[model samples]
Every structure is written in C-alpha cells, then in structure tokens.
Target: MSKTNQVKEDTKSVFQNKGSRRNFLKYSGAGIATAGILLMGCEDNENMVPDLDGVVNLGSGDVGVLNYAYVLEQLEAAFYINVVTNLYRNISDVERTMMEDLRNHEVAHRDFLKAALGSNAIGELTFDFSSVNFNNRESVLATAKVFEDLGVAAYNGAGKLLQNPDFLLIAGKIVSVEARHAAAIRSILDSDPKSFAGNDVIDANGLDRAFEPAMVLNAASTFILNKINASQLPTS
Candidate 1:
C-alpha cells in the first residue's frame, strides 16, 4: 500500500476505536441514569427532593437525615479515594493500609445511606477538592481531620432531628465508625489518643458537639465545589 494510504488507514482505525469508546461510555452512563430513576420510583415522594443539584437536597424528616448522611459520606469517600490515587511520598505501608481501610469504610457508609434512603435518596454529589494539596501530607491529613470531625458533629447534630428510631440507630452506628477513623488519623499526627476528640469536638459537659443542619452544611459547602441548597432540610 502507498505510504499516504497507510497513514490514512491508521488514522481511520484510531478514529473508529475512539468512537467505540465514546459510545460505550455514553451507553453506560445512560444505563446508570435509568437505574437511578427506577430506584427513586420506589420511595415516598414526600421524603424525596423535588429537585436535585450537584449536591443532595434532603427534603425533611427521616429522608432528610439520610440525605444528610449521604452527603457527608460522599465527601469522605471522595477524599480518601483522592488520597489513594495521589499517594504522598514517603508514606508508610501501614499508613497506606489504614487509609485504604478508611476508604472502604467511607464507601460502605455511602452505599448504606443510599440503600436505606431507597427512592427518597438524593442524587450523586460533585466534590471539589481544589484547596486540598494531595502532594502534601500535612494538607491531606488536615483536610481529612476536618472531614472526620465534621462527620462526627454532623451525626451528633442531626441525631435529634431524626424522627425514626431506626434511623437514629443507624446514625449512631455510622458516627462511631467515623470517630474511630478520626482517632486513627489523629494518631498519625500525634501520640495522644484523644487529640482529635478534645474540647473542640467534645464540649465541657462531655457531650459531643452538635450543629444544626445549616451550620454543618455551611462548613461543608466550603470544601464542596457543587453548592448544595439544603434549605429544604427540616429544622424542626
């Protein structure tokens, strides 16, 4: 074959491969969307958000609480995945294993919330971690600390807002795991076991710090690029 013709054939082959890949992705995405819609159909409309943004909108009551948990889980899951993806230099094997465990835990939490929420569950959230320096250990751990601490406080704060006893029980279970992750991350920075659980997260009365949904969402909004309009979440 002529050299020119050979080059043209190669280009055509490349284009065909690219087109196939693009089509595959498009179909995969469509399948996921369809499944999500079907899942939403099973839930009570009263509990589901009427509109979904990049962030979830937890309408109210038990549904609201589940959405809230889902959002936090999304954040944690994203953060740890980032850590694993861009591993810092000089990271110990033990540290890597522990962080992997944390990553799995966050995934489990996110999945649990999604399953529990059923049709009432909010859509997937977009995370923005531009401020996080994945290359720097300090920056990564600091952000992890913030997320872990916020998660604990979020559950503590939302506990009272939960009307369903089963939902509250689930929250308690998830938060305890979050607390353990926080403690493990804190130990990486300090020898003190109680470093992360100090007065800031724990009040003078020995109670865990709690924030209203608005307050927790406000803090969370800073790290999340996708703005969430959680005004619909029940305050009462």
Candidate 2:
C-alpha cells in the first residue's frame, strides 16, 4: 500500500483506541440544555424573526460582516449537529465526545451571531449534503476539517473589512476558537497528534490561511442551498 493509504489505516486504529466518551465528557460539560439556553428569548423577540426563505442579501457595513460570519457559523453548527445525531459506524466514545464538544462550540458561535445580528440576521439557510458520506468516519472528519479551516480563514480575511472595533474583536476571538477546532480535527485524522496545525494550512511565514469572502462562499456553495449574493459587502 502507498504511504497515504498506510496513514489512513493507522488513523483508523488510533481513532478507535483513543477516543472514548468519558474522556470528551470532561470538557465543557455543556449539553443540550446549554444549547437551548443560548437560543432563549429568541422566539419571543420580534427582531429575531428570520428573513425570507429565498436568496437573501447580506446588507453592507458591519452588519453585513456579522451576517457573513453568521451564515458560516450556521453551516458549521448544523453540520456538527447532524454528525452528532447520525454518527458514523464504529465511532468510539471518545470521538463521540469530541464531536459533541464541537457541536456545542459551533452552536454557541451560531447563536451568538443570531442574537447579535437580531433583525439584521438573514433567515436560516437550507443545505445539501448529497456529496458527503456521513456514514464514513474519514469522510465526515475530512468535511469537518474543511469547514473549520474555511471558518478561520473567512474570519482572518474579513478583519480588514469590519469597521467596528468591537465586531473585529469578537471576530478575532471566534476565529481563534475556529482555529483550535481545525487543529483538533487535523490531529485526529492522523497518527501524529502534533500534526494539529500542519504545513498544509500554515504557510512558510507561519500564518494561517485566509480567503476572500467571494471565494469562501463559492467553495461553501457545494453544501449550502442558498444563492449567497455577497455583492453588497463593503470593499474599502
């Protein structure tokens, strides 16, 4: 077998042995209750009402930036939640726990934006995962790695566009968390736990990757159903 195939086999063995539910349960310990709590008061608030189901325009300025992050977080949170609900075959308790934590973090990020954007937030988006094989552990982890990396890159690239200092600070904080998630997923995908932030994502300058908003949205289009019109976003 080739080196790449060999690594995959090795990763499977490690995943089965190392990931146990008890180990993951120790972190955060925030369960479904916490998720529900974060979304509290949203239903009653008139401003929390979602926009139309069709193609939504992300208005310009700081609000547009918030919605952009919000849209990505929605995707991440939904993806993780789906993974937790329909876990892959042979999933270890440790892996399950890790997934649960990711779900909680994504949910927190998603709800935070939802609450912050209030009336400005776009309606919830629909997704299409036909290309993703969720039942395959490798496939699911690979997809998660992609989403996490894209999220970090999106935040990093968006920093210059945000006019509000407070919004930029918040983005910085969330991007760090997204980076951590990306690292954790990368570590789990291989035998080398130290491979958390591999060279694939970090450049020679040791900088994490970044992408233009349009490019990020285009890549995300495969899984997202909405026609995201980013034309109105601030350029200066």
Candidate 3:
C-alpha cells in the first residue's frame, strides 16, 4: 500500500483502540442515558423532522442541539481527513501523528453523533476548503485552530439549549475533547504555552468563550456549502 494509505490504516486502528477507550470512559457513566438518546433517534417524530426544502433546519429541542453538533463534527472530521490524506510539506513525524489522532477522534465524534441521532440526523454535509492551502503546514494548522476553537465554543454555547441531561452530558464530554484539540493546534502554531488558552478565547475569569448557534454558524459559513437553518432551535 502507498504511504498515505498506510497512514490511514494506522489511524483507523488507533481510533478503534485509543479513541474508543477515551470516549467510552467519558460515556460510561451515561450509558443508560445515552441509550435513551438512541431510542429517541429511532423515533420518527413530527417535531424532530427537518424541512428539506433546500435548507437543513436543525430540528428542534435536544435533537436540534445534537444536529448542530453533528454539523460541526462533520466539518472538523472532513478537514482533518483531508489534511492527513494530503500531508503538508515538511511535516514532522510528531505532527503527522497529531494530525492522524485528531482526524480519527473527529471521525469518531461525527459517527457517534450520527448513530445517536439515527434517522433524526441530518444528511451528510458538503464542505468547501478550496481556500485552504493544504500543501502548506502553516495554512493547515491555522485552519485547524479555527475549526477546533469554533467546535469548542459551539458546544459550550449549545449545551444550555439541550433539555435532556444525557445529551448535555455528552456535549460537555465532546467539548472538553474539542478544547484539547484547540490547545494542541495552538501550541503547534506558537510554541508559547500561553497561546493554548490565549486571552482571545478565554476571559479574565479564565473561562472559555461560548458562541450561540447563529454566531457559531455564521463563523463557520465560509467553509460550509449547505445552507443550515437553526431557526427552530430552542431559544431559552
């Protein structure tokens, strides 16, 4: 197999073992609660249905919050998958491993949300990273930082909107992972440890910033090809 293919296989294995263990640990306490989510996903409820009229309405209530997260995971997963497949120039061994790990983790997140959402999940989203210079290490890492930070904020903001305790618990777990990814990317860009939790994203109280669904979606719109409607999402 080619080197790229070999890398893909290695990452897949890592995800199966390491990623599974990590997510399992985070989810273990909420197993029964998560199972409830799966049951909810299986149901064909009128309120949970999105109008497919050329736009994806993220549905409503807890399902809406989930689909919102699903969209972000899909974007992050796609970006890292591309970065791994088409490695940047002069990439180091450590960087390559980091990329692979990030890719697999995002994929695992995307797939888990998809499975949890079941039929209630939105269709696959299409992304446009044409502007990203995948061949350049700086460009790739910068974009990664953007995606990771955005993912962390999106989850933080949406957590309050979820009424289901199980869903909120899972979202909190996922956001913690996303924050780690953000910090990793930040550290890579600037060896300064402070950059990992810079003042830009963290307040004086040392709390991470959160962006509401609309704000998050707006920031992410530059790369997304599909028009998403979050109007039906819960307000309070």
Candidate 4:
C-alpha cells in the first residue's frame, strides 16, 4: 500500500480503537480508568475579540484556570443579581425568595474566588443578556438552568486540569454547590419537582457531564461582553 493510504488507515484505526481502549481501561480498574479522562482535539470556539483591539488573556498555568473560574462566577453572579433586582411580571414570592438566595450564593462564590486569587483574579466582566426575557417565568427559569448546568460541567472539566491539589479540592467543593444550583434550576423549569437530575446532564450510569475549556467557554461567551482565552489553561 502507498504511504498515504497506510497513514489514512492508521488514523482511522486509532479513532475506531478508542472505545475498545476505554473498555480495556474500564475492565482493568474502573477507578483508575476514570482518572484518565481527557478530551482530545477540542476546538477553540470562543468568539474572541481581536487581540489588536486588546482582549483579556487569562494568563498561563494555574492562574489561568482560576481566572477562568472567576470569570464564569462573575457571569453567574451578574445574571442572578439581575434577576433578583428586577422581578418579572407576576413573579411569585416563592420565586423571589429562591432568586434572592441564588443571587447571594453566586455573589459569595465570585467574591471567594476574588479573595483567593487576590490580584490574579480577572476583573469584573460585563454581560449582554439581552436575549433573556426577564418578564417571562419560563424564559428566566430556562436560562437559569442553562447557566447552572454549564457551571457544573465547567468546574468538573477544569478540575483535572489543576496541578495544585488545593485548587482541585476547592474546585470540587464549588462544583458540588454548582450541581445543587443546577438541580434546583432544573426542578423549577419542569412542572414536576422531581425532574432535577434530568438526562440532559446525568447519563445512564448517573455520571455528570464534562466539557473541555473551549467547549464550555464557547457556550458561555454569548452572555458576556468580554471574551476569555482559555488556551493557556493546563490540559494535563
């Protein structure tokens, strides 16, 4: 066979063998196998502002990861604050109380990161949530669910990327709280209160989903005024 043909076949086999490879690891030792989960070839879809115009570069190393989390928290905090400060038309007292709690929780998370990172923390980000219809309950709840779920996945994915065990431990704690927020938002979204752990985020094996930095940021960038470059974040 020609060299080009052999190369094409090799590449195809590699992808095709991924499932078998994953199965082998699973059979070897489930716990150890899961620790090796790393996404390959994830594209950078963040609509980055031209560097010529000056963009926010989330510095390299552990600091970049923290800045990424901080920026996400900033977005969440701003969103919940917006919802709480301006109650929608005919929004119930129950919703008002819940939103107030969410707002406070997000604010606490954002502030904690800021304090932890000190001067390394990313600056406050401005958001463009014009697509959200605050007056409509359905619209508000749906958006909340989206953000919370994304937050959980973002934390989970970034957890493995942290070199510092302290940072990883703290990220795990934050993700747990984010998962709770996701569940609460999901419950409110569906008329049935028991729909918190929907299939969208939780799989058949009851595992939470994870997205690489680029994937998460791309999904989230639509809401923020500033774009984040997470390329410098550690992958291993």
Deviating ranges (above 4 Å) for candidate 4 = 1-52
The candidate that achieves the highest lDDT relative to the unseen native structure? 3
lDDT per residue (tens digit) for residues 66-153 in model 4: 7788888899999998898777889878888788878866776676566555545566778998999988888889899999999999
Native-to-model Cα distance after best TM-score fit, residue 228 in candidate 4, in Å = 1.6
Off by over 4 Å in 2: 1-53, 192-194
lDDT of 2 at 33: 24
TM for every model, in the order presented, reads 0.77, 0.77, 0.84, 0.76
Q: Clashes in model 4: which pairs?
A: none
Q: Which candidate ranks first by TM-score, i.e. highest?
A: 3
Q: In candidate 2, what are the lDDT values of residues 173-226, reduced to their tens digit?
A: 789878989988988887786678778788999999888899899999999998
**What does candidate 2 score on TM?**
0.77
Model 1 misplaced regions, further than 4 Å = 1-43, 52-56, 191-194
- Quote the lDDT for 156 in model 3: 86
**Clashes found in each candidate (C-alpha, N, C closer than 3 A):** 0, 5, 0, 0
Q: Alpha-carbon error at 208 in model 2, in Å?
A: 0.6
Better of 1 and 2 by lDDT: 2
**Residue 141 shift from truth in candidate 1, angstroms:** 0.5
lDDT of each: 0.72, 0.75, 0.81, 0.72
Q: Which runs in model 3 stand beyond 4 Å of their true positions?
A: 1-44
Model 1 score (lDDT):
0.72
| Minimal lDDT window, size 10, model 1 | 24-33
Q: State candidate 4's TM-score.
A: 0.76
